[model samples]
Target chain A: MKPVEIIDIDVSYGAKKILEAITFHADAGEILGIIGPNGSGKTTLLKAMSRVVARDSGEIRLDSRNLDTLGYRELARQVAVVPQDISIGFDYTVRDIVMMGRHPYIGRLASETLRDVEICDHAMHLTNVAHLTGMSIHDISGGERQRVLIARALAQEPKILLLDEATSNLDVSHQVEILNIIRDLTGKITVVSVFHDLNLAAYYCDRLLLLKDRKVYATGTPEEVLTYENIREIFQMETLVKPHPLTGRPYILPVYTHQSGVGTNRRVHVVCGGGTGSDILQLLHAAGFTVTCGILNVLDTDYGTAMHLGLPCVAEPPFHGITPESLSGLRECLDDADAIVVTAMPIGRGNLDNLRVLLDYRTKPIILYSRNSNSPMEDYTGGEAAAVLADLETRGALRVEEAEELLARLSQGYSGRS
Target chain B: MRRTAFITIPALACTLLVSVACAAALGPTGISPGSLLSLPNAWTIIWDVRLPRVIAAALVGCALAVAGTAMQGLFRNPMADPHIIGTSSGGALGATIAIVLFAGAGRPVFAFAGAMAATFAVYFISRKRGKIPVETLLLSGIALSTLLAALLSFLMYTAGRSLHQIMFWLMGGLWNVSWDDVIVALPILVGCAGIYLFARDVNILSLSEEDATHLGVNVEGLKRILLVLSALVAGIAVAVAGSIGFIGLITPHVMRLIVGPDHRLLFPAAALAGAILLVWSDTLTRTFTNDMPVGIITACFGAPFFIYLLRSRMKT
Candidate 1:
């Protein structure tokens, strides 16, 4: 049996519904993450699984047993939850708090035995709160208090552990520390956690249950569930989704673009390559420019950014020279353009026609863009590309550093014509 | 809990024992230690008057203090007490009903029934989806207490000859405590013992109801059981001692400061300390204040202590 199997559960508070038709299951030794925006019922879903908030019409099963049939202590032996944070009302020592997790095991008449003490000690050691056993809970730091709470959950020795944004309040390093501790327990204990940080969830969770507006929007691997379109649609914002360099998991970088709306139907054809053109492409796109980019290899990062933004672009396959067909596509983009902009990407023989083609557009306003002046342009074409660049510059190809200055000059050109 | 609990529980027990002996010896009748052996009918005075009063005061104090600690821990608010939540008022109304209608027959039974009914009323009124928030709990208690007080005022207005007795009982004291009244208070130990069984559950519960449930505590059930037990204990204390006020409020706060907030240690420590506190308050009133109501003395100190708690709670 799966560790937790929730089928078509609907939860509501009075007249307000929280979750509807939620169906999912967590397997044995799997770490599942529930991720969503604020008020998306991420925490409410966790509460439903733990039986805190009663479900309206659904069944929750643990280890093949119906959840309704199990007693409170019996269910606690199988599932433990670590809250986001708790404000302890009393001055209890750390040991006293941890030992309370053993409440389900000890009978009403029996106090904790030596074995219970050993289990608590081992739990504290696992979460690194053993040294704070004698300290009052109020005296500990916020991060340390989170670890102690995790230790208390561990002391329950539950088969399934649930967390509700348990590390959301901690700093980056502390978040990493607590997530690493939780990740180490996977494959021995089944873990289901709600995460506010997408990157951490991508790295830590084996599977993700993406929620949107109290519904299961998607559920799959992080790579599948945390897609560009999915995140953009669910969160109503643009984000760049790429594989993490170290862990090979999906890493989401939010695209913070403000709609400048100043392009004003003036088409600007950009000749750029490598990853150098990705930022300007987004900035120019967000500024409402009718932008066209050209002649980049299919494998180029700039091509990916251009495609993500739905900008029309001329492209070639990887490891191939720019063909006559692509040259015509580039010529058409230049012919229809009000101005031409080129980022300071490296020049090579494979794509040297881009610079040579730029020399032909002398009548059009050609602005050579460089985000930083120190790294102008690298020529791997034996000074031939530099010669072409000098000829273009002599013919009034204005060079501008910084994307803001380039935007100002381009918008000024648009206004100057009117 | 184990470190100081070993010395603290025993030390408190011994202190209660010593305080009871001292309270019995010093009263308004003047039974000094030196003249006790030579005085005529000294044994009769101790047997018929002093011993029962002192023992009843100690038991009632233990009952009130233990109830207060449980209520504070259950509600997760240190300011919660039996008096603050209308348990004593319910019992006072019950006792007043007995005096006015039945000439004080079956007063303890009436007191207990009224206390339970009032507790359940406040509990149901404050509860929302099986959880009682601190704000609503306190507000409902105040609401019910005001209603009960209005009912009580109307009863006293029509009481006629019983108004004097009702007012005296309303301002709780230990003036006419006897061995029969002591029998009525003896079941308080049974009630306190019942509360002690859930000490560990109360510890987890004090953290937060959700956290307690994650650790396998039956939160709703635990609350119901603890509330019933507290009402029972506080109800009986009212029946015997006539609604003693802040022995419940002040004792738990002081014992929590001394023994920490672990309910296992806190329950016993506060019980002994409460018994000691009320015994002394009663003795001082009888010996020096010309037999004034002990509730007046307790309220005099307890009200200021409550204000200090409120001020410090705001600062924190």
Candidate 2:
């Protein structure tokens, strides 16, 4: 069952509507991450849930009860918020700040009981801020202060905790540390945090809500919501989406947009294997060339890089020699290419067809990148592959020693394709 | 820190006792130590004249300092005081109106009403949506205070025969205050007790309004209650002793530095420190010169300290 449900909420500041018809529900014992661009009402949504800002029209239900009917103290007992920036201008001890979270549980004239003190102490220990209990908050580091604020929220013993960019100011290690703490609290407490880091949200949150235009653009698990198209539409930036090798969660790599040189429209087919063509393919694709790779085994690292870059490829099954049908598919790719570039890859019996396909396209403008001068050592084909490479060079194939030299030659040879 | 508290509370209590005794003993007609053997004359002077004034000073000091502490906590700014948001000027305006027109038993009532009006005006003006941004509230308070001060000067200029009385009230002295004036201080005592009950809430408020709300504090309601109570205490203090300066502004700050920001300890400490400060300052005014206003002495001490606070805050 959902612990909290917000239905058709609308919030306005004066005449300006900050949020419109926003609806979502946070299940019990799950972390719901809110992700959006700035001014998309991410923080405003969190504030509305915490009742810091009153929603103009909507009903918020906590534990199946209408929120407006609950007293502030009762609501506070259930929900606690750790704000983005907590400025400790005065000298308040860490213990004193944490003890403030017990305000809802204590009576007006009564002080904190022994049990209350133990809860605060346990919260400090959970956040790793117990050692700084007696120290002034003003004297702590920023990361330590963030932890102390989280600890303060935890001391509320709240069933639901709301964090608004709580870890934005921390370094990577601290961010992971704090998020790990929140992640571990999932089974006992519900957490709804606004995250600026997409990767961190993907890693830590159980489900994600992407907001756009003051509404929920998408909501699902991280693998379902953090898609390249959704991110491109919302954030208006091109990104590469790949799965994390260890966790299988979606990871985002931002494509840099500051390329200066004019890119040509020429198509280049790279014939290489054993990870040699990875850098060449990346460079050519970044230079705005249509790149394709061919006759590569499916499990090869170069094929993996190609799949990650979304380039079309002709491939065979893992550890299988190139068949006649695959060689025909490579010829079709070579036919569509304006130029061909081959990297310094070892020639082997299992992939001898790759070198033979290159010989067939010898008349075309082909650049052979032989970084290793001793080609005989890589000839697992017993001088047959070496003899074929020597014949290709004699048939007017361009010999380049480095990737940069290969790029310089390609750009020079294909200038008119622009 | 607990050790400091153990020694400091008793030491402060002793100093307050000694100050009260010394202030009662030294006056225009100095009671000689040997003359204390004659109980009749000494008792008459102590009870009739010096005792009332000393008691009045202590009450006014305690009221103003506690009100100032509440104001500072409400605004979450150390520089905030009773007068920063025009509450004192509002009370002064009310008192001036009473003296100029009614000239009777309606002074405290009118003053309390005026202070509440000013507080509500600033509170409403500074509010946006549901939250009151501290910076906007501070700026609005300053703007309204300047406006109120102008209106007060105009009223003073127009009062022909009551001009001296108006100036004396505005200057804030403790002369000729009988037990009748001390009766106005009763509300201040009640208000201080009421504020102490919410001392924990006030401490949470010092963090931020939203933070306090998350901790189950009704921030808007708490602000309203504290603002009204502070204005009441400050208004009564002004009504009884005129508009004494600096005791409210400096005493709470000194106490906070010594006792930390825990309102539970800071409030009582500030009350004691304020009572002692005003009693001594009033004594100095009476002893060093004849019938000089105590307001001048407090301002003389308060103005430089205010500047020093500003400079130190800037450096930080």
Q: What is the TM-score of each candidate against the true structure?
A: 0.97, 0.93
- Provide the lDDT at B74 for model 1: 84
Instruction: For every candidate, give the share of true A-B contacts it also has.
Output: 0.93, 0.84
Query: Interface RMSD, all models, one decimal each?
Result: 0.8, 1.3
lDDT of each: 0.89, 0.84
N/CA/C clash count, model 1: 0
Candidate 2 residue-wise lDDT, A254-273, digit = tens: 87644434347778999888
Q: Relative to the true interface, what fraction of contacts does candidate 2 keep? A: 0.84
Q: Score candidate 1 by TM-score against the native.
A: 0.97
lDDT of 1 by residue, A1-418 (tens): 8889999999998899999999999989989999998999999999988888899999999988999898999988989999999998888889988898899999999999999999999999999999999999999999999999999899899999999999999999999999999989988899999999999999999999999999999999999999999999999998888899899999998988798799978889999998889988898899989999988998999998998888999999899999999999999999999988888999899999998987776678888888888987988999999899888887888888978889998988732221
Pairs clashing within candidate 1? none
**For this target, which candidate reaches the highest DockQ against the unseen true structure?**
1
lDDT of 1 at A324: 95
DockQ of each: 0.88, 0.76
Tell me the lDDT of model 2 at A136: 91
Give the per-residue lDDT digits (tens) of candidate 1, residues B96-142.
Answer: 79877999899888888788788878778877775667678878888
